[model samples]
Target: MLFLKNPQEAHLQCLTFKKEGKSIGFVPTMGALHEGHLSLVRRAKEENDVVVCSIFVNPTQFNDPTDLAKYPRTLEADRRLLESVGCDLLFAPQEQEMYPAPPVLRFSFGHLEQVMEGAHRPGHFNGVALVVSKLFHIVQPNKAYFGQKDYQQYLIIRQLVADLSFPVEVVPCPIVREADGLAMSSRNRRLTPAQRREAVILHQTLQEAKQRLLNGVSVEEVKKWVASVFAPLQKKDIRLEYFEVADGYTLSAVKDIHRHKEVVLCIAAYVGEVRLIDNVLLFS
Candidate 1:
C-alpha cells in the first residue's frame, strides 16, 4: 500500500519492480473512488503481479471550468478503497508534478475524436487522450485496466496504444451498475435524492433501446423510440445533450444498424448540473 506522489519516486519504484520481472498492471483514475473503479483494480490484481492505481483529476480534461471545479476529490477514502482492493501502489500526483507549465503537444484522432462524446464535449477527447497518454507513459505497465462504461474512451485508448506503439495491453472491464440499474459513477454523489431517482431513467432508456433493437427495429425507429422515452424529462430542468446510436468501434452514426457488427447506445445529459454518461453495446 505504498503511495508515491512524485514521478522520480514512482519511476524508480517501477524500475525496481520491472527488474524483478514482475508484471505491472495500471489503473488510472480521478479519485472519489467507487465500486466501479475497484472492479478495474481487482481485475488488475488478478492478472498482474503488481497493480498500480493513479488518482489524478486531470485539469486538462475538463471542457467546463465550473464542472472541473465541481468534480469530486476524496483522496483519503480513495486510498483506503485501493488498499482494500489489493492495489500494490498508488500514484497520486499533483498538477505541478504532472505539468509545471501548460502542455504544447496535442493529439488529434480525426473522425474518431469528432463524433459522439467528442462532438458534445469539444476538446474533451483531446484532453482525455493527452492525459491518458501521459499516464500510460508514467506507469509504463505491461497492462492497463479500464471500465467498459466509457466504451469510447477505451476505443480511443486502444487506438492511441496501437498508433503510438505504447507497448502496453489495454484491458476493458464491464460496467458496474447500482441495484436500481444506474451506472456507477463518482458524479453520482452530486445527484440529489430526486435527481438520483430520475438518473435511473438513463439505464432504463438504454435497456428499452436494446430491447427495441433486438426486436428488429430500424435504426431510425430505435432512435425515435429512445427519444420518446426521454421526452418527459426533456422539458424538465435536466439538460438533455444527446441521445445517439453509433458504431461501437467507429463512433459514427449508424446508417444501417442491422448491418453493423456492433452498436453502442450512448447518452450524455445533465441531471441537474451533474453531467452523466452511460452506454449499452448491441452486437449484431
Candidate 2:
C-alpha cells in the first residue's frame, strides 16, 4: 500500500525492512494492471513477508516511439489491484528519478539476443537488462518474480543476475493466458475486438504444433506445419515476425529436433499493429 516515487526513498525503505528482518519479494512491471500481472503479485505474497511491485513503463524497451506513447498507464487502478493482491509496497519511479541521464551502459547476450524479439526489437533486451538491473539494486529483494510469458526476457535476466552477481533470486513463473488461449499481455489493451479474435491464432498455432509433435511428427515436419499455420495469419494482416522450433534451454534454433533435447515452439506476430508472442515446449 505504501508508494515510493524516488529510488533513494525506495532503497532506504528496503534497507529499513532488511534491518527489521522482513524478507522482500519483488514483481517489476509496467502498469495497466491485468490478471496476468496480478498472478505474479499473488505468488510474491505467498513466499515473501514484504512484496514490492514496481510500475515503471521502461522507456528503453520500446522499439517504436508510437508504441511507447500508446502504452497504457493506469497507475491508480494498478495500485488498487496490487493492494488487493496484498502487495506491501509500490515503487512508481518517475522517468527522471529512474534515468537522470540517457543510459550509457548496455548488455549483450551474444547469440541469445540475435533472434526472435531481439532481432525485431534491437537493443530491447539491453534496455530490459539495464532497467531490471537498476530495479534489482533499488529493491534488493530476497526474490524477484517474472512471468514465463516473456520466456527470453526471463532467461536474459537470469543470465544478467549470474553475470553481475545480483544477490536476489530471479523466479520464473508460468505464462498466464486467457480463456480462449491468447497469452495475457499488458499490450493486449491495444487490440481491437476484431484483432482480439484474430490474436487467438498465435496460441492455436502453437497448440497444433505441440499436438503434431505429440502425434510423433518429425521436427522438420512440425516446423513446416507451424510455418504453414502462420502463413494465413500473415496474409490476413497479422505480420509474422519469426516462427521457429528451438532448444528450450538455450533458445537456439533446432535444425533437426533431437529426441533427448527439449525444444520450444515460439512465435511473434502482429495482429493489426499490436505484436503478440506465444510459445510452447516439445519434450521427448
Q: Best candidate, TM-score-wise?
A: 1
lDDT of 1 by residue, 164-250 (tens): 999899998999999999999999999999899989888888888888888888878987877677678866657667888888888
lDDT of 2 by residue, 130-172 (tens): 9999999999999999988888888889999989999989998
Q: Name model 2 segments beyond 4 Å from true.
A: none
Candidate 2 weakest ten by summed lDDT: 253-262
- lDDT, candidates in the order shown: 0.88, 0.88
Please report the TM-score between candidate 1 and the true structure: 0.97
Assess every candidate by TM-score.
Answer: 0.97, 0.96
Range of the 10 consecutive residues with the lowest summed lDDT in candidate 1: 231-240
Q: Model 2: what TM-score? A: 0.96
RMSD of 1: 1.2
